[model samples]
Target: MDRKGWVMRAVEALRLATFKEIQRYLDEEGEPFSKKELLDTLKALVAEGLLEEKEGVYRPARKKGSAEAFRRLFGD
Candidate 1:
């Protein structure tokens, strides 16, 4: 998947995570996304309305459309 997609999936699964948490998760999955790369992707995702960030923690944006999108893809 693309960087945005990969980051989105990570945030979706995590619900909320700090930058390092996301990076560690990706690293565990063998992604090797650098801190800068992850930060860049997070910024882009937030700008594109795909993710949200607060107090340096990131999560999938929980707007109605995004929630429905997740439900459709993952169920419940």
Candidate 2:
């Protein structure tokens, strides 16, 4: 039940979330993630190639196709 931070949010966002939605979810949690934290997580995922940056937006990598996709999308 202790869900917060990069690892956890990655999965939720894997379904391809909008920035507002992500920010909103974090806000609903009481202490929302700092902009730095959010940026770092996305940047890290982009580096790993598990995320695709398009038109200034970030989304899950395309065609995951397998369980490994889920793993890459999230889970440390």
Candidate 3:
């Protein structure tokens, strides 16, 4: 998957995470993205309404019907 997709997966798996935590999760998944790359992807996801951020923490956006998209992307 691409950087955005990987970042989204990291957020989904973590539920709620700070930047360092998300980076660590990516590293643990063998996807060692640079800090800038991860940050940029996170910003894009938030902008696209796929993710949400507050107080430097990130999570998958809890939009209505968004779970279907998540299921399609990541399965049950």
For model 3 the local lDDT of residue 39 reads 88
lDDT of 2 by residue, 1-76 (tens): 3333443464455466655566676677664677777767767777877677766566666765778768877975
lDDT string for model 1 (1-76, tens) is 8998788878887889999888888888888797788888899999987787889988887767777889979999
For lDDT, candidate 1 versus 3, the one ahead is 3
Runs of candidate 3 exceeding 4 Å displacement: 66-76
Shift in Å, residue 42, candidate 3 = 0.4
- TM, every model: 0.80, 0.54, 0.82
Considering every candidate listed, which one attains the maximal lDDT?
Answer: 3
Model 2's lDDT to the true fold? 0.63
Model 1 local distance difference test score: 0.85
Give the whole-model CA lDDT for all candidates, comma-separated.
Answer: 0.85, 0.63, 0.91
Give the Å shift of residue 24 in candidate 2: 1.2
Error of 2 at 52 (Å): 1.1
In candidate 2, how many Å is residue 75 off?
A: 21
Kindly give the stretch of ten consecutive residues in candidate 1 with the minimal lDDT sum.
59-68
Q: Whole-model lDDT for model 3 versus the true structure? A: 0.91
